[model samples]
Target: MSKVSETTLEIDLRALEHNFRYLKSKLGAETKLLAVVKAFAYGSDMVSVSKKLEGLGVDYFAVAYVKEGVLLRDAGIRTPILVLHPQAVNFDTLIERFLEPSLYSPRILKEFLKVAEAKNQKKYPVHIKFNTGLNRLGFWENDVDWILKHLNGTNAIKIKSIFSHLAASEDENEKDFSLKQIKSFKKSSSELAEKIGYQPIRHMLNTSGILNYTEAQFEMVRSGIGLYGYANDAQIDSELKPVASLKSIISQIHKIEPNESVGYNRAYKSDGYRVIATLPLGHADGIGRHYGGGNTMVLLNGKLVPIIGNVCMDMIMIDVTGADCKEGDEVIIFGGNHSAEDFANSAQTISYEILTAISQRVTRKIKE
Candidate 1:
C-alpha cells in the first residue's frame, strides 16, 4: 500500500483475521462470538474493522454507545450490535437503529421500557448487566427480583442476554475473585431465567476471561482486546500478532551542544553534544504528556532512541546520537519487535491505553 502522510497507523487486516481465527479456535462450534468494536475498534478503525469482521461471519458486534452502533448500521453492517452502555436519552435512537442496549441499572431498564412501549415495540433485544464484582455498572444481584417484578407484565422489551464483567481475569492473584464473579453471574442469570420463563444468552468473559476461565464461557463470548491481538499474558501475547503499527518519519535532524535545554518547560537538558531527530507527530496523536522527557522512545531504523523532550502537541524530539539514522528515515512509535505492550510498559501503563490512545486524526491505512 502507498503511504498517506508523514504519520499513519498501519492496521493489518490480515493480522486481525488471524487473531479472530485464533480466538475462535479456543471456543466450541456452538459458542457465538461478539466482536467488541468500541472505541473505534480499540483505536484502530471501527468501520473498516467491523466491515471486515462482518464479511468473516462474526456473529455480533459491540460498541460502547448508541451512536457508535448507528455508525456501523449506517455503514451497512447488518450484524446485531450490542451497545455496552446506553444513556436514557438515546433509547429512542437505539430502538430506531435496532441496537441492543445493555441495561445495567433499574433506572435505565425502566426508562428503556417506557421508550420501547411508547414506540410500540415488542421483544426488543436488551442485555442485562449484573454487578458481580466490577461495581462500575450493572444491577445488583439482590435487585434481580426487582427486575423480574418490573418485567412481569411488560411487553415493551425482552431479555436478549445476561452478562457481567470479570474484574481481574488477567491477574493470577485475583483468580479466586474472578471465580466468585463467575459464580455470581451464573446464579443471577439462572434466577432471572426462572422468572422470565426462558433463558437468554449468558456470557461473562472478556478476552482474558476467555483464556483464563474457559469453563465459564456460556452461550456467547465477547472478545475485545483479543480481537485486536492482546491477551495480557506473555505466552499468549507471543501467539498474537500486533495489528496496529504507529509509524512516522524523521522530519528534521538537529545537533545540540552541552547544557542545552529542550522543549516546553525545559523538561530535557542535554549533558553534552548530542544528535536529535524531530518527528512531526506528538501528544495530539495520542502520545500523552506522561510519555514525555525520556519516559519512552521511538524506533528509528530498527534502533530504539530515547525521547529527549516534552511531547509537543504536534511533534516530539528524540535522542539519536549513536543511532545510524537521519532525517526522512522511518520512525516506528510502536509496532513489530517494538511492541505496544513494551512501549506502554515504559510509561507504566497497559497496552490497551497505548493502543486506544492513538488519536483519530492519525490516518489509518489497511494493510494486508
Candidate 2:
C-alpha cells in the first residue's frame, strides 16, 4: 500500500504474475504466450510490466505501434516483440530495432518490402494478419493470391506468422460466429502457407478464445486483457487478480446545506445536510464525467461513497455523510473489493476502456 496522501496507480507485480500463470495454465507446454503490452500494458506501466513478463519467460510481446516496440527495446527487453499495427514510415526504425511488423495490407507489404530491399535485408520476419471476421486491418480472404503474388520473389522478408482477430469470442451467444472465424483463419492460413512454400506459425485465439475455443489454440495465443486481469467471464474473473489499483486521498471535506449545489453546472444538489469529500482525481485522471452524479462510487474505509458532482478535470466530490472517513483517508477508485469491471460497468463502459483510459500523469508505483 502507498501513502494515503498521494494519488497513485499501484501496480502489483505479484497479482500480475498470478494472472499470467493462470492464463498460461490454460495452454500446452509448447504453446507460445504473447503478452499484449500495448497502450502501456493496458494503462499500467509498460516497461515495468514487460520487465516482469520477460522474467516470467513470456514467449513474445505485442504492441500496436513501432514506437512502443522501440520503447521496449530501448529498455533492453530481449523478448521478441511484434508490432500489431505498424506504419510504413517507421519501417526503418522497426528494422533497426529488430521489431517484427504485422503487414496486413498489400500497400504495407509492398512498402516494407521496398524498404527492406533498399536496406539489403534478407529474411526479415513479418507477421501477416487476415480478416477472418474482424474486418479490421487485415488482408481479406480474396486477397490471398494477391499477397502471394506480391511476396513470391521477395527475399527481403519471410512470413513469421499468420494471425487474425476474433470479433466476438467473449460472448457466449456469438460462439457460432467465433467458430466460423476460426474456420476461416485456419483455411486462409493453410492456403497461404501452401502457396508460399512453408508453414508459418498460425494463431487466431485471443484471451477469450483461449478459454472458450481451446481446439483452435493453433501454435500460439495472445493474452491482452487477460494479462491485465479480465476474461470477460464471471468464472475466470474470480480466478484472476487485477494488477493495478487506482487510489487517491480525500483532499478536502465540506458540509453542505440544503439545496446547495456541488461542482460545475450544479450537477448535484444536497437535499438536506450532507457531507462531501473531494478527491484529487477526475476526468483528466480517467475518472470521466460518466462516473459522476451517483453513477459510480469509491471505497473509503470499507464504505462505498457515491460520487455526487460533475467530474472536473482535476477534482470530484463524493458524498460521505454516513461514513467515519475524514480528509486524507485513502479512496479506492478501482481494484481490491471494488473491481475495475464493476466501476466500468457502472459507467456504462467496458474494462478495456477504463483501464486503458488511465492518464499517464498519475504516479505508478509498482509493488513486488
| Number of the top-ranking candidate, with TM-score as the measure | 2
Clash pairs, model 2 backbone:
none
- TM-score, candidate number 2: 0.99
lDDT of model 1, residue 275: 90
lDDT of 1 by residue, 50-113 (tens): 9989989999898999999999999999999999999999998899889999999989999999
Identify the runs in model 1 with alpha carbons over 4 angstroms from their true place.
1-5
**Residue 84 in model 2: lDDT:** 97
What is the alpha-carbon lDDT for the whole of candidate 1?
A: 0.90
The Cα local distance difference test for each model comes to 0.90, 0.92
lDDT score, residue 46, model 1?
95
- Residue 272 shift from truth in candidate 1, angstroms: 1.1
Positional deviation of 162 in candidate 1, in angstroms? 0.4
lDDT of 2 by residue, 1-368 (tens): 44656888999999999999998899988888999999999999999999999999999999999999999999999999999999999999999999999999989999999999999999999999999878889998888999988888878899999999999998999988988888889889989999988889888888998999889888899999998889999889999999989999999999999999999999999999999999998899888899997979889999888997799999999999999987888999999879999999987999999899999999889899
Candidate 2 residue 234 Cα shift, in angstroms, is: 1.2
Best by lDDT: 2
